[model samples]
Target chain A: MKADTNLSEGSGIPAEARKILTQIETDRAAYKRKLVISFIILAIAMIMVLIALKLDFRFMKNQLPFIFAGMGYTLLVSFMAISLACFLAVVGALGRLSKNPVFNSIASSYVSLIRGTPLLVQVYMWYLALPQIGKALEGYGFTGIQAFFTLPALTAGILALGVCYGAYMTETVRAGIQSIDPGQTEAANALGMTRSQTMKRIIFPQALRVIIPPVSNEFIAMIKDSSLVSLMGVWELSYRAIKMGRRHFQSLEMLITVALIYWMMCILLQYFQEKLETHMARGDRSIR
Target chain B: MMENDSPMVKITNIHKVFPQDVHVLCGIDLEVKKGETVAILGASGSGKSTLLRCINFLEEPTAGTVEVDGITIEAGENDKLRNGRIRDIRKRTGMCFQAFNLFPHMTVLENIIEGPVTVLRQKKEAATAYAEQLLQWIGLSEKSDEHPSRLSGGQQQRVAIARSLAMKPKVMLFDEPTSALDPELVGEVVEVMERLAKEGMTIVAVTHELHFARDVADRILIMDNGNWVEQGPPEKIFNNPEQERTRQFLAHIL
Candidate 1:
């Protein structure tokens, strides 16, 4: 018994250490099983890809580079449109939160009208109707109205997408602003801050934490919805793919390639979104 | 109650009726002289907190006149002042919350200096220097760089008091500053308040701690159903009961 005790102590592996080692082993085994499952799923995905490649992919092979080149336009339009949307969303959120009836009604109408109509219809309206108004203005001897009304197809598409997305994002921003505890506002007021000062100094900083995740989600969705801009004859990813496929009568191959590219872009965006979430949650981690 | 000096804070016939005719504060009249620490004690929903909140216009009294350091604001039925006057009144009063509502995104030092630097338009370095002193006074100098979320309940409340002090308001309002604290954490906050009282700070506190009221408060006001049931020196309020309601409340809480 003494030898056994001495050996165990000398080896530095006590009962508690053995228990921890067993727990670690179980955890590692569970992780290994998950890895195996992921590999199986990846293999299935690879097999599907092989089957798709075996199909009539000659047109896709020739056109993939050109369609991929259009990724730049797709990204550029999405970036500009999303930037514009964020600005409009902030302004709309303020209007929604404002007590003034004029601002309130204007914001309410904008959101109702935009959200009520489909994006496709709005794109057409911007692309088609504005130039008609420009021509009518020219007929009425308002020659300077040309710049105001006659927007290029790309410009119209961007504005329509921005305005429509802004309407949806307004509600998200409003909810985020309101979700902060009333106690925070009360505290700010009791500290002698005016309403705007309170909002700028205390409330908005906190609200941004809750607002960012959903806003990032909207951005991801915006990248995909940007395809609708292609309807206005903007040479983006989907437009290039469609044009190429129709010319070669192999629409399925070109469309599938575009879909894969979109999937890859979305995956990349999700990875960055997770990193941003971790960065934002740094201050909250200690307490949680 | 003094002859020559004006009241540090005075509220006359303040009334608050919420929507659906629920009267939260019904005709509260109060006066606290300079250097006086008054404790208003009552059970939850008894309107003690509401009365305290109304003094700072945190809840706009449906009817009342409030004077802080002789600057007065009056409100009647459908009569309200512009945001300017409200802001003016609030600047003269510093309030500490029960939840220690420090701006979580800011460090303790930043929370302390925000009001002074922004509303008061004090120089940032001067405000920061003063904040350092206040933090030191509250025994939180070491934690100035840390965020509120990382601090314990007691530490957060102390930093909150320091934040209020940084504004240099004429009077301090504490709304049950320790009611949310852990049992072990309550004493630290109470000790800080005790020190503030000894240093002659004008304070109106809505509190649940009977011992704090009995020991530190110059006067004790007991409320029930939005009315003050009793008000007197702490010894009289604690030892020589005048109203049955006061006695019952003491029995329940103490």
Candidate 2:
């Protein structure tokens, strides 16, 4: 309480409210500076869009849905790929930690080979090399397996992305499991929990917090990289955008719109990421 | 469960050494009778904590045998024993770490219930009830659903004590439970241990807290340089220390 007279000067209100209002007013200049900076960035982005459209604005609206149609395909592929990657990550991580040398070595080699090579090369190999693999299998008494060699474009793309991300995800899971204090396991052991019980009940829940943010980051990256699948004729958002841009001779407009859409999607992803992170962090009260 | 009054733990000529040519423990032997609380006091690197770990088979002994309730626990010729038998020994002993080691992602209730559900194969409702009772006993009733990170260090350690107790362990091994807590928080944990001792639990503890040993321990074994320098009732060990090392240890503490 500063003084009764100071409080009465504001009348019928708490002194704390008066103090808060005064502080907000005092920071008005700093708020104005931040507002100006944001406004300038928005203006620059709008001007760039206007200049791009002015150069080639013919039939832009007609191609909008055609280009935007690819968004569904993109989401469909990334969702399937991430689901498969999650499964592989769990299995591969467990295999890496397994006591059996045969399984461990197989897992180790898979991770190394997948991580060491470029993902594009793997995509090419899976699509082009699989026919040869199918042919060899047919030679081993499997007949008319040519159809097996022929993977649908979406399936090929999903397999490539899932396998590539799975390798990296295996390491993320391993690091997370290792991050837990050794004493937690020892305590679980002392309580007569079997190895599986300790892992499922005590270790995995804690490791999840460490694993999710990086896994989500990988998913976000995979969204952008899904464009590479268009090379195989999957007709995704990127491919459609390019084709329509060339047809209408408004490549700049069409491309800018696509870019803007991608940016907006990423912004949405970033928002969801922050929300998920906050939920995870809420469980660990140490921050408060 | 083993009888409450039986000799709950037996350690016979245990030795452990790492691959790096360092002899951590050499020819140690000890036994703990049920309903007795024994405190192992030692200087830094004196093998007290290692001995406690060996009883629970957490640290594999390099040689010799350990028995729990007259049953052989761990056996090997000159190396770490077979994993299956070592895990069997661990089942009979409940261990509490200095750092509490509560599962950070789990609530206090979940941490306490986990042991019963996994070890005893108890139903969820039964385990939850058992854990709730233990939580109440440990004075953490208000924080049953709270994660370990939110609890005070002393409260988390109490939750750990309750978690270990839920398994109905024949023996409890505490490795410096209070050493990891803030100085002001030490009394709360020591008081919990005192209550457990009063209830006649067979416990082996490694600690630097002279007051806990003085008040609660039936016998105190002082170690120096990986050997038991002295062992007797705390009265004789702390007040009338016989060996030079024990005398020096007492001098530093008292």
Candidate 3:
């Protein structure tokens, strides 16, 4: 391989430089070969997908619009839930990090309890158990309590998801805040800034750069997790797919279609996550 | 210079004890007159930095009082200093750290202006103008918009100095400001401190750089085991120290 470097010989380049260039050219060729192999693998996966569909393309095409219509609800639940989760995570993290015993216990218990229980059970508790508690209160002469407790399916789904994810994200947020050096806090304090002021202006802003990427990752997972809301009889993508599949007795087809849709949505979100990571990292000299 | 006899900073019997009976500072007392520079020299863990931190209450003294620019804070079990009182003392004293500790998320100019705008509630434009001037003084005007991570260690330390100066503090505290820098880069930061000292800024520094202490400080104090072993003018302390401990420490370092 080294003997074939006549390309740069006439350009008066040194032997060491020409050898390095040859290595780079070899690397580029290997990368191109790998790219071609990756595409072939993807083509094989597509063929597997076709076999899984059992050549029922017409049925999938016809059901696509009906299932796609529920996408709005799916996205809405995830977005609103994630927003609520972020707010709760910040508060919970602060609570967990607080010096006061009461705040610390409340934050730790919230995380422990939520994370310990199953999300499905929590969803049912929000949609079903709350109304029962409200009814019990109504028996004590609390007028309109049952009605207030009985939430719509979408609202209950968002609450359950948000509370659950908030518990998980509390740890993430706490780790991000702790990742910052203590010197930063001392510097801010030395400048006469109050504790809260230091946190708001100096600590939190820097922590956000560390927290955003993982938070985005949680968001992608929530997109798929939002499907759990379908059990509440909401018209989200999964509910619509399951309902249509049962009606037409093609459950496998509907399930496969909905799975692909969720995968696509996550891919789109991952793209946006990379863009956000880059934006947050602008202060750093290294882009990646 | 002798006309102003009032002390800019006064400390009385300050004692600091860490948990588990680690007595880091014990019964230390000192005073600095206005416009005078005091340099403290000691081996590491001798409480030199802790005493400086006590001045701004970054490390609260378990006993004794620290009075800065006429405001006094005393340590006692029943008497807790209010938040406002701590802020008042902190605002009057500027601190420069060995690691620079510049806010990595902000540009150099923003880092400088942060204390002015947030703590002092100065107008943004006015704070920025002062920050720019400080940057120019430190010869970092060209790097104003750059983040602290992008600058060299020397440049970041200079920027850190500028950040402290933006608050217009009555006194400056340097905690081994040049100890973290490369040997070649230490000169730039030391030069800035020398310039500041010459301009009549009151400074108390804990440093390992012997040249900086000798050339820049008006008075020098040597500490060992949380107590001052010797104190005098730099020439007297460096050439003819009274204490055996101070002599040994200097012999090891110099």
TM-score for each prediction?
0.92, 0.90, 0.94
The best candidate in terms of lDDT: 3
iRMSD value for model 1: 1.8
How much of the true contact map at the interface does candidate 1 reproduce, as a fraction? 0.66
lDDT score, candidate 3, position A168: 98
- For every prediction, compared with the true complex, DockQ reads 0.64, 0.53, 0.61
Ranking by DockQ: 1, 3, 2
Model 1: residue A110 alpha-carbon error in angstroms = 1.8
Once fitted onto the true fold, the runs of candidate 1 whose alpha carbons sit more than 4 angstroms away are A1-28, A39-46, A49-53, A56-59, A135-143, A286-288, B1-4, B77-81
Question: Candidate 1 — which pairs collide?
Answer: none
Which of candidates 1 and 3 is the stronger one according to DockQ?
1
Q: What's the true lDDT of residue A96 in model 3?
A: 98
True contacts kept of each: 0.66, 0.64, 0.68
For B28-125, candidate 3 gives per-residue lDDT tens digits of 99999999999999999999999999999889899999899988888863545566888999998999999889998888889999999999999999
User: lDDT of model 1 at residue B185?
Assistant: 95
Q: Write the per-residue lDDT of candidate 2 for residues A1-288, one digit (tens) a residue.
A: 354356568776786877876676668868999999999999899888797657554466777788888999899989998899989998899889889999999889989999999999988877878888889989998898967887888889999999999999999888888888888788888787778988998888888888989999988888887877887898888889888888867788778778777788888998899899999887655422
First chain TM-score in every candidate?
Answer: 0.85, 0.84, 0.90
Reference-based lDDT, each prediction: 0.88, 0.83, 0.92
Say which docking band candidate 1 falls in: medium
